[model samples]
Structure formats: C-alpha cells, structure tokens
Target: MLSKFYGEIFAILTSVCWAISALSFEIAGKKIGSLPMNLIRMSLALIFISIFSVFYNGNIIPQGANSEQLLYLVASGLVGFVIGDMLLFHSFVLIGARLGTLMMTMVAPISAIISWFALKEKMSLWQIFAMLVTIAGIFIVIYSRNKNHKKIEAKTKKASILFLGFLLAFGGAIGQAGGLVLSKKGVLNYDAFSASHIRIITGFLGYILIISFTRLWKKVFAGLKNTSALKTVSFGSFLGPFLGMSFSLIAVKNTSTGIAATLTSLAPVIIIIPAIFINKEKVSFLEILGAFIAVIGVALFFI
Candidate 1:
C-alpha cells in the first residue's frame, strides 16, 4: 500500500520540513540578511550533509559520481539554490513576499514542461488535473493573504522596480524549473544523499564567489558576530539542506519530476498548523479550505 505512494509521501515530508526551515530561516534572515545568512546556512548544511553522506553512503564524497553527474548536480545547485533564491529575494525586496510567493507557483508547471521535453516524462490526465488543483488551491490561499494585507515592503515606490520584481520572480521560477529537471538527470544512477551534497557544495561555492566579487566579505563577517542568528541558521541547515532537500532528491528519484514538484509545493499548506502553534500568522477558514482542497488533489493521485 505504502510502496506506491512512497515518492509522494517523501514529497509531503519534504514540504513539512521546508515549512519548519522556512520559519527558522525567516527569523534568521531578519537577524542577519539573506546573502550572509544563505552563506552561513549553506556552510553549516555542507558540514551536516557531508557527515550524513559519509555515514550513510560509506564515502566522504560521491566517489562513484562521474563527470556528467557532477556537472548536472552542480548546475542544479547553481540554478535552483543560488539563482532561484536570489532572484526570489530580489522580488521580495521589490514587490513583497506575498506577490513573490504567488509568482513562485510558476515553478511546478515550468518544471513539468521542462521534464516533458528534456526527459520525455509525461503526466496522466488525472495527474495533470491533480497538479492544477493543488497549484490552484495553494494559489487561492496565497492570493487571499495578499488580498487582505497587500503589503510590499520597499524603500522606493518606483514603477520600474515593480516591473523588475515581476521579471525576477519569473526568472526565479525558470531557475527552479531548470534546476529540478537537471537534478532529475543528475541523480540518475547516483546516490540521492551524495547528489544532495554535491548540490550543497555548488550552492555554497556560488554564494562564496558572488560575495568575493561583490566585496561583501565584511558583511558576511559581521553576520557571524550574532550568536543567536548562528543558532537559528544551524537549526535551519539541519532541517532544510539535510532533511528537506535530501527527501526532495529521493522523491524525484522515485517519482516523475512533475509529481515531485507539485507534491513538495505543499509547504504553504503545511505551514498553517505550525502557524497556529507559533502564533506568528493568523489562520482563516479560507486557508483551511485551501489546504483541504490541496489534500484532495493529493488524494487524486492514489485514485
């Protein structure tokens, strides 16, 4: 019974883990900033994942990884973790988190189309319907929040900046889509955990190179002074890169890329219950309804 659903189960677990990490990362980002905190979390995540890879895979690194595997995984990290996240951050800066998140909903379909062409992966009619349902459900919840609050924290209220924000958000979707497709290719005949480590390595290095050229070393160093932020980042690293991303890879390995993307996209829905506990955000009936709708969409997979 569970075997057939294992991929989706892992994807849902990935969503839950991402919700937890996103909350922690949100706090850390407030304490420190996105770039510096990204470097910190990725560094710690590298250490954590390395240990896991060694213990679980019996190798310090992916000893069996060929050149092609390395290339694909590295590209996945650069596109997904670095470029996608950075562009989304810029969108947050320009348009606000609400709109940015709405834009990110593009990733699932974009990734689906990419996989269809690149990997010759195809979805069933039911699967397509389910994916749209899930995406639409999540969008309804996200859109409601934006409609009620409609807050876009920005220093400048420039029209050009808002337009740029839209572009960046779309770019983020494309980056993530490309990364998912590449990861599916990369992890072929490779250990998922090891592939995840390679991704972490590339993402960390990408940030390092960017910071180096931008001369943000001082800012990065300054971020290290805050002990509280470090603790938060460490926790986030454990949940996100180690657990969340690893499960994500496993999901993709076991399932089609489109299904994995849609299933993992349930983070917003999963975050609601936790929000109740954390008392950070208010939950409403619409959110609850949307979550139920999303679950119905997930259930459609089994049917």
Candidate 2:
C-alpha cells in the first residue's frame, strides 16, 4: 500500500524534515545573520550530501548528468538556494519560522501557476479554485483585523517589519516555486540523489561568489566561531539541503510536480505543534483554521 504512494510518502517526509530544519535555521539565523548562516549551512550541506553521494551514487559528485540537466539543476540551485533561501532565512529571523513557513504554503499554488506557463501544464477548474483557497487561507493567517473587524493600519515600525517579513517570505515562495518546476524538468528519469547533489554544488558555488563579491568572509568566520550557531546550522543543513531537498526531487521524479509540491507544503501545518511547544509560540485558533483550510486547498489538487 505504502509502496504505491512512494512519492506522496516522501513528500510528507520532506515536510517533516523541512519543518524541523526551518526552526533550526531560524534560531541560527537570528544569531549569525541570515547571509552568514546561509553560506555556512550550504557549505555544511554540501559536505553531508557529498558523503551521501559516496555511498549512494558511488561518487563524491554527481555522475552521468548531461549538459541540459546540469544547466537546469544549476539554475534551480541559484534560484531556490541562493535567492529563495536568502529571503526565507531572513524572514525566519524576522517573523519566526512558524509564520515564515506558513507563508511558504504559497509554494504549491505558485508551482502550479508556473507549471501552467513553463511546462504547458493544464489545470482543471477545481485546481484553480484550490489555488485561490490556498491563497485565501494564507491571507487569513497573516492579515490582522481590529476589534470592529476592520483591517489594522500598518502605521508602526513593528507592522512595517512584519510586512517586510511576509513580503520576503512570499518572494521565497516564488523562488522555491520556480526552482521546483526547473528541478522537475532537470531530474526527469535521473537519480534523485545525484540530481540533488548537482543542485547543492551549484548553490554552494553561488554562495561563494556572493560572499567573495560582498566581502562577507569576516561574518562567515565569526559565524564559524559561534559554536551554538554552528551546531544548529549543521543539523539544519543535514535535514534541509541534504535530506529534505533530495526527498523533494524523489517526489517530483515519481509523481506530478503539483501533487508533490502540495504534499510538501504541509510544512506549515506540521510546524505548528513544534512552534507552540518547542518555540513556545502562541498559535491562535484562526491561525490553526487557516492552516487547515490552506492544506485542504492543497489537497484539492490531488483530487
């Protein structure tokens, strides 16, 4: 039974892995700054993925990938890892992982829309309605109302910060959506692990370039010395870029990208319990309802 839904199973697992990793990255990002944290985590993830490649692919680097595959995968790394994650990690620091990841539920709809244009993929009316529901749920969670059920004015510094954080999270969604589509294109009929390895390599090199041009090595060195942050980043690196990303590729390879992305977007719901207990966040009833509604919207895609 489970074997029949291998892609769905892995997509669920990817959500779990990503939920935990997002919390870890949030903690570390707050301490080390998002830029440094991203560089270091990518570096650590590269090592972890390389080690896995040795056992799985029998090589430390991806093997047998053609030029076209490499190009798409590399572009995915740049868009997803460099741009998307940069925005996401910063949002984590600003808004907390719970809300930041909640915002990421947008990835499913965004992926579906991108696929429609990029891959000539068609969506049913139900799927279109699903996307709207997903967006509406996200708005319910993020938007605020006053006592009279009126929209709150964003006239304060705190509101501005929250607005920026949500905006960045949305940008991250775009990056991830674009990357997922590109990954599906590149990883077709390819080994998921090796394909992930290629993406990570590109991400690592992309970060190196950014750090070099921006002269952020000092911050990177400082982050390295922060043992607490280092430990948190290391754990996140394993779960995130290594396991979570590889599992995502496996899901996309085995199933439709829309279905796989929708399943993985359950991270918002899965992260709620952890946010309440581990992070000690006070989740409101509306937030919970919004999450379920969003997930229901995503689930509609599977039908």
- The best candidate by lDDT is 1
Off by over 4 Å in 1: 151-156
Off by over 4 Å in 2: 87-103, 123-153, 157-171, 294-303
List the candidates' TM-scores in order.
Answer: 0.95, 0.84
The clash numbers for all candidates, in the given order, read 0, 0
- Model 1: which residue pairs collide? none
Cα lDDT, all candidates = 0.88, 0.82
Model 2 error, position 31 (Å): 1.2
Q: Please, what are the lDDT tens digits per residue for candidate 2 over residues 81-159?
A: 8889778877876666556766776788789879888887776687578767766665565532121222232333387
For candidate 2, list the clashing residue pairs, or say none: none
> Candidate 1's residue-wise lDDT over 32-67, tens digit each?
788888899999999998887778878776678899
> Model 2 misses residue 269 by how many Å?
1.7
